[model samples]
Target: MDAFGDGNFEQSEIDPAAEFLAREQNALAGLEDEIPPLPTGPVDDDVTQPKAEDGNDDFSGYTVPKQVTEEPERIRKWREEQKTRLEEKDREEERKKEELREQARKELEDWYKHHEEAISKTKAANRESAKNAEKQFVAETDEIEPGTEWERIAKLCDFNPKTNKSSKDISRMRSIILQLKQNPISTNKKV
Candidate 1:
C-alpha cells in the first residue's frame, strides 16, 4: 500500500530486485539437490530401451498386437458380400427410377393426344358455323334493289377497293354488316 501512496509521509524502503534474486537462487539450489548423477562407465547398445521424442514418452515402448492389426477370414468375406449387395441395391433403384420416368412420359403423350383431338373437333364446329352465317348473309342481301342503301353496301362488299375485283376477306365484310344491323343509323335525322 505504501508503494503506490503519495510521498508526503515517510515509509520504509523495500528493494524488490534483491528479493527476486534471492528467491530464484534458492529455487536453483533445490533443483540441483533433486537431480540424479550421470554414470561414469562405458555405454552399452545391445539392450533395447524406449526413447523420448519431442518430450512425449507416454507411447515410447508401446507396440500394436498382431491380432488387432490383421482381420480374420470370416470378417473379410462378410465385408465383400456387403459391398456386392450394396451395388446390386443401387442398380435396382436406378432401374425403378427409369421405369417411372418412362411411365410418366407415356401418360403425358396420351394426354396431349386426347387434348389435340378435342381441340380439332371444336375448330371444325366453329368453321361450319361461320360458313352457314356467310350463306345466310348473302341470301338476305340479294333481295335488295340496285338503288337502295343495302344494295350499295352489298356491291361494295362484292369487290376489294385496292384490287377492283372479288374480295377474298369475306369475314371482314360479314363483321361490317353484323355491326350495321346491330346499330342502325337514321339518314333523315339532324343532330
Candidate 2:
C-alpha cells in the first residue's frame, strides 16, 4: 500500500527522513566492528607500555613523558658565546664609524687650508695693486711745474715742493683735495 492508500507506491517515493535514519544506522553498525573496546579498570600512567588491570596486551598511553626543567649546560655556553660575538661586532662597527669621522675631519681641514690660502693670495694681490697705484700718483706729482695749479695744490697739502714729498698727514690732504674738487671756489672772486 502506498502512503496515501493508493496501490501505486514507488521505491523513489520513499520518505527522505526514514532513508536518512536507515543510512545512519548502517554507518553506526560498521563503526562498531572497527572500534576497539575501552579498558574496564584504571589505565597506567606510563607512556611506553600502559598496563591494564585485565592484562590483555601491551598498549602505549597518549600522555607525554615529563621533561627536565633545568637548562642544559651546552645550550647556556652557546648563548654566552653568541652574546660575546654580538658585542664584538658592535665594537667593530663603532670603530669603523670613528674612523670615518676622523677621515671627514681631515678632509674638512684640508679644504679649509686651501680656502685660507686662496683668501691670503687675493689679499696680497690687492695690496700689491694699491702700492702700484700709490707709486704712479707720486711719480705724476713729482713732475709738477713750480707755478702750476698742481704745485699750488701740493703746497696747500703741506708738501715740500723742492723735495716733492708729502708730510705724514697725506690722508688728510687727499680728503681736502676730494672736497675741493666736489665744491670748487671761483678763482675770479675777490676775498
Candidate 3:
C-alpha cells in the first residue's frame, strides 16, 4: 500500500470487443473521405449497379448484391421445398408399387380359387364316368349263364354258381370263372 502509483493497472485493460469497434469506426471514417475509382473495362453484369444506358441514379434495375460469406433465406427455403417435393414423389411411387403388389396378390388368389374349382369339377366328372363304365361292364357280363362253361371253374373253386352276381367276392369269382372258360387247359389245375 506504500507504492507511488495504484496497483490497479490490470483492471484498466480495454475490452476486446470495444477495441474492435473502435478500429472499425476509424476504417469507416477513412473510407468516407476517399472516393472509389470507376471500373475501366466493362463491368461484370452480376454486380448491384444501375444500367449505364439508363443514366438513372436511383435503385431501379439494381439487383440485390449477394454476400460471399452468407446464403440468403430464399435459397434455403427453395431447397427445403425441393426436398419436400422429391420426398412426396417417392412416397407416391411407393404407394403405386404397393397397390400393384396388392392387385397381383388378389389375382393370384383368384387364379388359385378358379383352379381349385376346376379341379373339383374334373374329379367329379371322372368319378361319374368311372361309375358309368362299371355299370356298362356289369350289364355286358350278365349274359353268361349259370350252367355254361363258367360252372366248371366255379365247382373247382368251391363257389356257388347260382349266386354269381351276389357280392364282390362272387363277382370276382365270376371273372375268374370267365377266364377259365376262355382257357380250357388251366381249368384242370387245382386251386
| Winning model by lDDT | 3
- The TM-score obtained by model 3 is 0.37
lDDT for model 1: 0.71
lDDT of 1 by residue, 1-191 (tens): 56868767865586889888998998798787686654434434543334467777664444332333578999999999999999999999999999999999999999999999999999999999989988987886887653356444654563445664463556677677656655655566687
lDDT, candidate 2, 74-109, per-residue tens: 999999999999999999999999999999999999
Off by over 4 Å in 1: 1-68, 143-185, 189-191
With a 3 Å backbone cut-off (N, CA, C), the pairs that clash in candidate 2 are: none
Work out how many backbone clashes candidate 3 has: 0
lDDT of the candidates, in the order given: 0.71, 0.72, 0.73
TM, every model: 0.40, 0.36, 0.37
Candidate 2, superposed: residue stretches over 4 Å from native: 1-78, 140-188
Q: How many backbone clashes are present in model 2?
A: 0
Name the better of 2 and 3 by lDDT: 3
| Local accuracy of candidate 3 as per-residue lDDT tens digits, 1-191 | 73858776465588999999999998799786586555545446656665556686665443544456666899989999999999999999999999999999999999999999999999999999999978976775686554455554454464565655564556575676667666654344577
